[model samples]
Structures are given as C-alpha cells and as structure tokens.
Target: MTTEAVLDIAVQALMVAAKLCAPVLVTALVIGLVVSLVQSMTQVQEVTLSFVPKALGAAIALVVTGHWMISTIVTFTTDLYTRMPALVGH
Candidate 1:
C-alpha cells in the first residue's frame, strides 16, 4: 500500500478504537466527577467510594453497549479484510 493509504487506514483504526471505548470512558468520567463532588460535600474522602461507583458505571455502560461494540468491531474488521486484496494490489 502507498504511504497515504497506510496512514488513512491507521487513522481509521484509531477512530474505530476511540469510538469503541468512548461509552465506558464517558461513563467513568461522569461517575468519577459525581463521586468527587459528593465526597467534597460530605467530606467522606474514601478512595473506595469513588472507585466503586466509577467501576459500576463503566460496567453498566459496557453491558448496555456490549452488542453495539461487538458489532462495530466486527464490521471494522470485516471491512478491513474485504479491502485487503485491493490494498495489496491483488
């Protein structure tokens, strides 16, 4: 493949990876922010308190988006494979 084509593919792969991870990451971010606010308000400051909620939120996000995530990855992989021959000048 040409240099530009290889870079394009790499960028696309990165975008796909970011899209796949966004849900869980956002969930954790929001949960951590809320937990931080609560801890600040109540002065509880328990590290585990922040961790548990974030973990649960991430787990929930993964569960909810699991099917979509799998389908997206599968589609990306299938498309990549289908385009390989052309990319390889076959």
Candidate 2:
C-alpha cells in the first residue's frame, strides 16, 4: 500500500480501538476519581478502597457494555479478514 493508505488504515484502526475501549476506560476513570475524592474527604489512606471501586466499576461497565464490546470486536475482525486479500494485493 501507499504511505497515505497505510496511514489511513492505521488511523482507522486506532479510532476503532479507542471506541472499543472508551466505555471501560471512562468507567475506570470516573470510579478512580470518585474513590479518590472519598478518600480525601474522609482521610482514609487505605489502598483497597481505591482498588475495589475501580474494579467494580470496570466489572459493571463490562456487564452493561459486554454485547456492544463483543460486537465491535467481531465486526472489526470480520472486516479485517474480508479485506485481507485486497490488503495483501492478492
């Protein structure tokens, strides 16, 4: 492929990756921030407090978005597989 085509493919792949990870990452970020806030307010320096919420948040996110995540990954994989020959100049 040409340089422009390669870059375009890379960009598209990155965009898809970001989209796939967004829900989980956002959940983790929010949970971490909230837990940090609570810890600060209560002066609780326990490391477990931070970890539990983040883990729970990630689990909840996975449960809720599991289908979407699976579909997104499957679609990406299928698309890539179907285009493999063309990508390889077959």
Candidate 3:
C-alpha cells in the first residue's frame, strides 16, 4: 500500500521472474556461443545449425527446470498472498 511496500513487491516480482528465466536463458546463450564457435571452426554457416541447437538446448533446459520453476513461482505467489493483508493494512 505504501511506496516502500509497493517497491518491495515490485522488486520481489522481478527477482522471481529473473530466477524463473535464468536457466533457459543461460542455456540458450551457452548453446549459441558454442554453436557459433563450431560453425566458425568448420566453416559451416548454416542458420539452422545455430538455431536448432539453441532451441533444443532451451527446450531441454525448460524441461529440466520446469518443475522447480513452477514451484518457485507458486511459492512466491503464495507468499505474496499471505502478506496481502499486512501489505494492505487490512
């Protein structure tokens, strides 16, 4: 309800979002870099060569971390809900 409370909620939401996205983002970044390196070394300048690996890596990352990501978001939501009354001074 207050400025500080609103800022706190906003920061927490952003943190949760970053935490949720980190795994897949990191995977894609790494995959892209590696694919680029391999393409350079082999002189294979195919778009799908880079794209497919990054996509598959991201998909695998999502699969591996999906449950944890869901649980983390659920926990954040539940905590936010639990603090709602206090946050609203109700």
Candidate 4:
C-alpha cells in the first residue's frame, strides 16, 4: 500500500474511535463538572459523591448509545474489509 493509503486508513480508524468514545466521555465530563460544582457549594467532599454520579452517567450514556455504537463499528469494519482487496491491489 502507498503512504497515502495507509494514512487514509489511519485517519479513518481514528475518526471511528473518536466517534465511538465521544458520548461516554462527554457524559462523564458533564457529570463530573456538575458534581464538582455541587461539592464546592455544599462542602461535601466525599469521594463517592463525585465518583458514583459520573460512573452512573457514563453507564447510562453507554446503555443509550450502545446499539448505535455497535452498528457504527460494525459498519466501519465491514467497509474496511470490503476495501481491503482494492487497497492491497488484489
């Protein structure tokens, strides 16, 4: 494969990874920010106070987006496989 083809594949893989991770990462970030704000306001410095909510939020995000995420990855993989023969000039 040419360098350009390799770079294209790498870029596509990175984009797919970022798309898959975005939902859960955003959920956790939002939850953590809110928990931090509440902790600062209420002076509740408990570890679980911040941890539990962010974990639950991330879990909920994953649950909600799980099907879409799976379909997206499967589609990407299928497309990559379909393109492999051409990429390899076979």
1 or 2: which has the higher TM-score?
Answer: 1
Please, what is the TM-score per model?
Answer: 0.97, 0.86, 0.97, 0.97
Candidate 2 — which residues are off by over 4 angstroms? none
Q: Model 1: residues >4 Å from true position, as ranges? A: none
Model 4 steric clash pairs = none
Q: RMSD of candidate 4 to the true fold?
A: 0.6
lDDT of 1 by residue, 10-75 (tens): 999999999999999999999999899999999998889999999899999999999999999999
lDDT of 2: 0.87
Residues 1-90, model 4: lDDT tens digits: 789989998999999999999999999999999999999999989999999998899999999999999999999999999989999998
lDDT of 2 by residue, 21-71 (tens): 899899999989988999999999999999988999999999999999889
Q: How does candidate 1 score on lDDT?
A: 0.94
Which stretch of 10 consecutive residues in model 2 shows the poorest summed lDDT? Answer: 1-10
Over 4 Å off in model 3, which ranges? none
Tell me how far the alpha carbon of residue 87 in candidate 2 is from the true structure, in angstroms, after superposition: 2.5
Checking candidate 2 for backbone clashes, the offending pairs are none
Model 1, C-alpha of 37: deviation from truth (Å): 0.4
